[model samples]
Target: MAFHKNLTRVERARLAVTKLICPITRDALRVIPLTDFIFGIYISSRYRYVYIDNPKTGCTSLKSAMAELELRGRKSDLDPLNLEVIHYDSSPLKSFVPIFPKPTLSNLIKNNYRFVTFVRNPYQRLLSCYLNKFDNSTAKDNPQARRMPRGAAPGSFSEFIDAIIGQTDHDMDPHWRSQSINIHYSRVPYAYIGRFENYATDYVTTFHKLGIPADEIPTLRHLNKTGAGRASLHEFYDKKSQDAVYARYQDDFVNFGYPYELPD
Candidate 1:
């Protein structure tokens, strides 16, 4: 809601009127439905740092880190020199969604705004996703769990990896950097770049560089959402699945400096 800070008083007033013309409510604008097509302009104008959620990339923990840095409020009185994190509950690559068109991540970068993001190794990430789908907490009632989606329970972890890696239904973009290019070696000035493996150190360094105090950082839960539920990386992915994940993500691996060796 505070992301509307870049708007003029008159512009904000006009946006309010425009909202009334559509399905309008306070919480709707705040959190309920996460979409850049609906609220991108407001968010981009207010926050300089944008967290592009590519799903299952330790997003909850990253959001907590941003909140700890006091970037959640509707308005920030802090100096413009500080980082303003813009979080998207959904993927910003609107082309995948029929109702929404493409967003302007390229334009924002061209404007010289500082950007940062985190990435997880794809093989481990896939394993974690399978475990989450079958994790008991997801369905408290045994009967309800029976109604879960197909491929939710592939029986074995290897089967789950085979299913996910074998299928080509989902988006292939890497979650770490905003774009698929050379994420770690970008010549542009980035405030900070983080790895999911070393989140605490990377997070603290980013905030410190931004002049935020150590006390301002909050404790986190679910910090290892990237790979916490996996029983064994070796057992989960076979050589084929490992090679597929690596082949598909080679660009991201080389660009972000992630280890690209196929799992043995």
Candidate 2:
């Protein structure tokens, strides 16, 4: 309901980060890849838009749309999926390279060319991660799993939450890491931060904020969706487990305006 506000989303986000996140988190977040282009960081040099890709929240789907846009004037050599993959074909569209001398990255953020990212409710995102990644037997086969404390996938959702809370000494898995830590809006500040729950309106609002025409914005592909769509998070959590989750991801809930109180 609040698109095109007098104070922009970027302005509000920068304020929220400074006020809500402690100095320690702000420092930790700043020490990340300058652009993080290798992961979900999608940038369009032509349009001057940056989308910080958060895993489990429409990463591949949005990437597909961006991939299509990348081919606008360039050669249409790669197919949709290949375009999303980080390769030579996609290089021309990238806003910045992941390197020390990142003038392109600095210019974009400093010049304010519409940085954006999507977020989901912390509880739903956790359930999606469990049902999609940690709950599986084959997750240990993932490259990052080799570095996990257990050297294998968490056997259950409860165990996964424990892993997140307990694995302070090791790198936290990005799929389940705190959104506040990942986006670090205080440090970089997004022009628009859309919610996955309100994907329809917020998705449109993103382009609107960027001054992109509605006709040019393509529909997002629903990629890598996990488990039954109807399954409620309430089913997976007991009061105790739910409380554990709240303790673990309290900042996410508080920052995103999500309810953490356990259902009656």
Candidate 3:
């Protein structure tokens, strides 16, 4: 047992001593340099950290904030010395599997970086994903396209609800929150959490707690900017379709605190 190097004193000395022989690795380490002290101290100071992104959430804004911190040297963004950020887009499981045994989260927690994530209402998320995939020419031509709109049909929201509710294990990307919930049946201990409706307040409050300056918090960017208003959408959904959709996303509705009012 490597004696859990992140926590133990002996392991720290071993890593430090080992670095002297590995000069190439040592030089590389300088850029994102992490000695045992910095790693241990960082983990101790932070509250908690976990960015559970589930597409549709305002991830770009969060990424920008993190980039700023990295530039300042107050934190590192994939620094050769410290690969603190875990990006799912590029570093897929196959590439990262061999390094799984290493203490990854231990360093983040030690460094005072808090875990965070945002979730959108399932109904709206399904709608956005469906449109982004089929209605758009870019996705319509792609082989990986999951659900293409039928014929000259406009891909009604009703159809979107049916596709999601009527399938099992259908989503290609195994969502982080869903998998975590399935495995643990507990909400992840996020230092901050945000929902689509209240993202502005949540975003500012969360980073403020993390010591980000009030003036620096980025404005919330709505990805689905152009739309007929929620009231119009509410009028568009019929009672039967609404009921079915609610039944489909009951888990998300409950867990994420979305209100579902059956049409009168």
Per-residue lDDT, model 1, residue 20, is 51
lDDT by residue for model 3 over 145-221, one digit each (tens)? 33322223235656655545554432322221232232111423457667655767877776776667777655554
lDDT of 2: 0.63
Question: 127-231 in candidate 2: lDDT tens per residue?
Answer: 887777755536436754554677777677777777677554126666777777677655656788888878778877877887778888877667777852456
- lDDT (Cα, 0-100) at 27 in candidate 3: 42
| Higher-ranked by lDDT: 2 or 3 | 2
> Model 2: which residue pairs collide?
none
Give the best candidate by lDDT: 2
The deviation in Å at residue 180 for candidate 3 is 7.8
lDDT of 1 by residue, 1-264 (tens): 222436667656655654454332232343222232233222223334544444456655655555544444535443222223323323221112111122233445555545565566666655555565554235644431332234244576555444444333222112211224323224334566676667668766755654556876556555534344346677666677777767765666776677866333
Q: Cα-based RMSD of the predictions, in order?
A: 10.5, 9.4, 12.1
Find the number of clashing residue pairs for candidate 3: 14
Candidate 2 to truth, TM: 0.77
Alpha-carbon RMSD, candidate 3: 12.1
lDDT (C-alpha) at residue 114 in model 2: 76
